[model samples]
Target: MKTVLITGCSSGFGLETAGYFLKQGWKVIATMRTPREDLLPRSEHLRLLALDVTDAESIHHAVEAAGPIDALVNNAGIGLLSAIEGTSMDLARDIFNTNTFGTMALCKAFIPQFRQRKSGVIINVTSTVTLKPIPLLAVYTASKAAVNAFTESLALELAPFNIRVGLVLPGLAPSTDFGKNAASRMQNVFPEPYEAFAANFFANAKNTAVVTYAADVAHAVWQAVNDPSAPMRIPAGADAVALAAQSL
Candidate 1:
């Protein structure tokens, strides 16, 4: 059975994708900052490990413990919603630390193994905000956009070694914890005129229907891993598909 190592499997897309792979008869090494056995079924095919994507030491240890793997899913990310003027440099750096550097660190950890094996897959979970600009997401979008560019270039670099790289763009998934988490960390910088505009913008954005489910993201990851000819970018939600169509 092929083995896959996934990051941030405690909840959201990571958790869903881990469950999906286990059902498909694949051995799954699910890593999160906090490992929770109750979050997933107790199966021989599933192993939970602790991984802090932002820390190089933590990443090194987790990769070492994960052993040989067929695929690596860079799904761990944190989102932020704030205008550029409202966002502080420290806050922006923090988001990039998790959403950008974290993903790249995991890739660096596993690329040697994938290269040596000459057969492996890497699926990165990025946001559709990269394609379509939305208000109050400047930092978050910029971070994911970096990952999108990195994945595209890395795909070409690794293609000769048969190491496939794919990117999954998920749209606004209101049902997921991402929004709640982002809201909790949202900067309290809405002062004066910007506050009213920010409020209006967010309210309007939320009014739009949410068609993206966590399962849809997992399905995209599944296809990206199993399909040898999968495109570098895979849209994982209805809104994301529409946005991608606009780009086309």
Candidate 2:
């Protein structure tokens, strides 16, 4: 059976993707900052490991423990909803650390192994905001946008070794913990002048009917990992799909 190592299996798309892979008869190594055995179904093909993507030591340890894997899913990420001026350098750096650097670090850890094997897949979970600009998510967009570029470039470089790179651009998921986490950390987000705009934007976003779900993203990741000829960027939701079409 093929093995896949996924990051950020604590919840949302990561958790759902892990379950999907397990159901498909693949050995799954689900890594999260805090592993909860109860979160996933009990299966002999499943293993849970603790991983803080932002911490180098944690990533190194987790990858070492995961043994050989056929695919790497870079799904661990944090959301930020703050204006540029209001967002401190530290806050911006933190967002990049997890969403950008963390994914790259994990890729670096596995690249040698993948090259040696001459076969592997890297699926990165980015955001649709990179395709369509959003107001309050400038920082978040920038971070994911970097990953989009990185994936595209890496795909070209890794093609010689037959390693595939894919990107999943998921739309806004109001029902997921991502919205709650972003809201909870927005205390220092908007300046006084932009408060009204931020409020209206969020309220509209929540009430919108075009939100994506964990399953949709998980399926997209599965498709990306399995389809060797898949596009570098795959839209994982209705909203993202519509936007991507318009872009073309």
Q: Residue 15 in candidate 2 has what lDDT?
A: 91
lDDT of 2 by residue, 172-218 (tens): 88767887766766786789999999889878886888878899999
- Candidate 1 total steric clashes: 0
TM-scores, all candidates, are: 0.97, 0.98
For residue 211, model 1's alpha carbon misses the true position, in angstroms, by 2.3
Query: What is the alpha-carbon lDDT of model 1 when measured against the actual structure?
Result: 0.91
* Per-candidate RMSD, Å: 1.0, 0.9
**Model 1 misplacement above 4 A:** none
lDDT of 1 by residue, 38-131 (tens): 9999999999999999999999899889999999999999988877887889989999999999999999999999999898999999989999
Q: Which residue pairs in candidate 1 collide?
A: none
Model 2, 151: alpha-carbon shift in Å?
0.6
Q: State which candidate has the highest TM-score.
A: 2
Instruction: Report lDDT (Cα) of residue 153, candidate 2.
Output: 97
